[model samples]
Target: MTASSLTRPSSKASACGCGMKRRAFLRTTFAALCLPSLARGNGPSPLPSFDRCLEHFMAARNIPGGALAILRHGRLVYARGYGWAQREQQIPVQPTTLFRLASLSKPITALAILRLAQARRLSLDEPAFDRLGLAPLPGKTRDPRLEHITIRHLLQHTGGWDRAVSGDPMFMSHPIARACGVPSPPGPRDIIRYMMGRPLDFDPGTRHAYSNFGYCVLGRIIEAVTGHPYETWVRRDLLTPLGIRSMRLGRSQLRNAHPGEAHYYMADNRTAPSVFEEVPSVVPAPYGSFCLEAMDAHGGWLASVVDLMRLSAALPGHGGSLLTAEMWQELVRPPAPPVARDAHGRLNDMYYGCGWLVRPIQTPPGHNIWHSGSLPGTFTFWVILSNGMAWAVLFNQRREANGLPDTEIDGLLHLAAAHVQEWPESDEFPRYYRPSS
Candidate 1:
């Protein structure tokens, strides 16, 4: 794809989310394309109002480091980094800095499923367990209701597992590893077999509950159907075609943090029993409390805010580069029955749809779709709206010093943009971060 073709207003979209080939982008951009404008001497950016808002939010929480990129109608308008990415070594966060994308992985996995469906590789209504054809763990009995769970139920988070009631199995790495008779941090297939033996919290497709294990199974399903590893298929068929080059599954240890990845911090400065060991041992909660490798489909991605914003803008609804218009609408439509109602909302405005949190609006005649990610030391947010505006912000710490929640960024970003007297006519996508082709 040419530089002009990437950022220009064009409606050419692929039936499946495949466009740019990786071979065409054999030459990579020198790490950070926006370093001159974003990271080097952050003095007077074009959007100083946004800079102030982000800086204030970080200062109030004493957040170690963060990076943000904003897009309007598929054009990157602003990109910046703030504070130290590694405070101990004085490494500054850059627009290209990669952070663990907790639940934001859901949207990416969900989009992959939609793309596969668009290609007629799978059906949403197909029984998930039937499709995988994997057996339950040795000697354990299978739940009959497991046969009824469908791909749509998993995508909608209407699958039976409820983290609040039954406790999230994805976090129980040690126990699962023990049960599956495998090494510490068992892979996705072992996790799925272990889950198969347990009874679900509720019947499938009856209600909505966010599930990490559900997406984990989706990962294994992708592997089973495509005859390739989940990461291999996603990069080859989904991400590369979308012009995303740097994203990949993250590892659990600090030493394993991907190159250009930010180090993590905890606000409480607490530790937990390392999931990798049977003996009682404490490690930094962010680095060893859970197994990121096990959370591949739901929350294991490492990426920069710039790459995430590119994904948001390149998605079907925003730039028409992924699924067809009909499947895009199908992607957002809330399922029938009680699943349509919001789980935590006071009104009937927002609900979980496929991979995103959906809020239908009146004036725009479309919906606002977004997803947030949370882990021991990471908090990330991505938003794609109907008005052709999108923003992605990522932090190295999950908590704040002032007792403020991570979700606070949601409102502050909106307010900052609304208060802006003017937005630049420039498109940063091409000038700042477009990879060499």
Candidate 2:
């Protein structure tokens, strides 16, 4: 899939639900999944300590605002926001603020697929065409290997589908069908047809490479099996089950979303305020490109730090919601050995597990799995150490394309990882300059 193909529809489409019955079911499920601490907490507020770090970091990098969430042992221990969510409007960011997850939305979509798989609604080995009954594209590659393409292939980024990177013709002022060479940019049904038109980059099981097309296909499959639109199925079945109420799946919903939502920014460089785009709705496809929308299934979920935590904490062995324990294990387990990476000379190898980029971190205690998301003006990362440590960092500035090295953001994350502790402390702040004792 091209970048544009990742856009999801705006939330304008009603999810495939019967009526008040579905709404009541969703509300009850949401109530059941509520986190332990969301409502009441007298523990030291996370704000004061995080405020110091965020203020310093933003000033140092010239980013207007950001948010971070940390969960320890499945409880939301911290959620903090800083800077201007709306710089032009002079609005300040608050802890409850929301932002588009961009590619980070993939994990959520992946979870929805897994939830279906656990229910035996589909199987990993189910052929893509059979699962969705999607037709093959005309004049596309006729490789029989595609018959072996499973839901798992889509999750692991090993589907061998080609991605047209670096352009937004789908977002340009042109017809979607003409912009993309297919007869018509097939809705959820056409993704596989589009892929059938292309030859495999490598045999499906061999090595690994990132392909948004694989994910887009998976999203389509979810909709097909659930008899619901991609966003509705995900929100009703997945997010609601996890008690994540603030998150939304498509751009139309985002545009009409309430005021507390954070706006998106595009950076020209690292040290300046980002140019904001406040479109009423997003075009979802090719997740990282263009603005937000509800067109693509593989990406486009807008969320808050708490919502991301709801997801991040939910995947560690399922713990009685959404996916089953066995399915969650399959999600976190190491991928096929051949695809593991040791590129940094790190002792442990990493692979992509269903819907997640699995990296085994070499920390003193052992290793942890981690994934990071980078969109136009925002970048976020999360790590869940098997030993029960989870930390996340989210930013609202895109510094790399604007002549600023990505190291600036990396540096902040590195600092956070080094200094982060379970206990809040004023002394935890690293002094920018220390006077002589």
Q: What is the TM-score of each candidate against the true structure?
A: 0.87, 0.71
lDDT of 2: 0.55
Best by TM-score: 1
Residue 24's lDDT within candidate 2 is 57
User: Which tens-of-lDDT digit does each residue in 1-437 have in candidate 2?
Assistant: 21111111111111212122444534432333232222222564444434444555455457767777666666666666667787889777655677766566677778888888888889886777566665556655577778877777777876665434422222332233442453332244444454465567677866666776577677778878989988788878877765666677544322465567665565543222211233322332222234244235554666777677666666643243556768867786655545554665433344678876554434432334555565656666555555554655666664544443332332333334333455443321112112222
Clashes of each: 0, 34
Query: What are the per-residue Cα lDDT tens digits for candidate 1 across 115-199?
Result: 8888999998999988787889989999999989999999988989998898888888888899998888787888889889998
lDDT score for residue 323 of model 1: 80
List ranges where model 1 is wrong by over 4 Å: 1-43, 278-280, 342-347, 400-402, 432-437
